[model samples]
Target: MAVIIKHNELEYAAKESAISEFALLTGKKQSGAEKHMKYDIRMLEAGRFSFPYHFHRNSEELFVILSGCAVLRTPTEFFEVHEGDVIFFEMGPDGAHQLYNHTAEPCRYLDLRTVSGLDVCEYPDSGKINILPEQEVYQTGDQVDYYQGEAQVRDKWPESVLEKSR
Candidate 1:
């Protein structure tokens, strides 16, 4: 079976935060695409921003400008992208990017991502790391050694088990 979603039938859901706000219409999931990729159409309101300046450790992304213009900020430069423009972001620090709808009108684009099993997204400006699916965000500077919390593990064993082992 094939799923065909008409442009006129797109249902947009609003998402808002302090710095970013956009209306998103999810497409890949509705099309029964499960593993390799995911995609959504986003309408970014004027004066609003997209996700923060971040990049993925395991996944790559692409953005296709659908209707309006926006300023794209990458690690080394900032430039304008208009309708019909396509942008590709690789995995890692070099791919760090953010977008802002600077025009008076709204800007719409297609956000496509490669769905690798898990992804770790790093925010350079905020020094934070986000784990996808789990949706957990943590400070990058708060990392600890692998065995940092493993001390006194033997104390957790039962007395009967200890005696049996002895």
Candidate 2:
């Protein structure tokens, strides 16, 4: 039987699972996650984040604003979205994005994601993918130079300082 989610039910469900669902996201943390179909909608409060700054190479994200507002933060910029707003984030370089609830009141929204196989995500600031068991993860930054093969390096900083003195 097909289940039709009513307006009230959706609101209740979002609030009930919002916190737990957000915390359930794991695996490297950078690549983000897929919310279970049961909790397809998410409601967040001020200072709450939907996901870390990451981009899925495969899946597309869709959002329908239900109440309050949120700031959709992208790699290069951000957009302030409010109720009645409908938006879709595609997959690719231009599609990478994350959203944040910045209003005093909780912002409720519908998040719909299409499964696009197993995808690797990248964090712009961290420059690392929470690589799944199948995907390769890499570190990116100006401070660290890339190397191939079994590279060896000696840190100039004292290794002794990192250990706890007994």
Each prediction's TM-score against the native? 0.84, 0.61
Q: Can you write out model 2's per-residue Cα lDDT over 1-166, one digit (the tens) per residue?
A: 3445555534333222345424212111121334432125566667777766777776777878887898888757998999999888777657777778777887777777776457767777567875543757777553343565335433544668646543
Cα error, candidate 1, residue 100 (Å) = 0.4
TM-score of 2: 0.61
Q: After best superposition, candidate 1 residue 133: deviation in angstroms?
A: 1.1
Q: Which ten-residue region of model 2 has the weakest summed lDDT?
A: 23-32
lDDT per model vs. reference:
0.84, 0.64
What is the model-wide C-alpha lDDT for candidate 1?
0.84
Candidate 2 residue 92 C-alpha distance from true site, Å: 2.4
- Model 2: residue 88 alpha-carbon error in angstroms: 1.4
Model 2 bad stretches (over 4 Å): 10-39, 132-166
Q: What is the lDDT of candidate 2?
A: 0.64
lDDT of 1 at 53: 83
Tens-digit per-residue lDDT, 41-93, candidate 1 = 88887887888789999999999999999999999999999999999999999
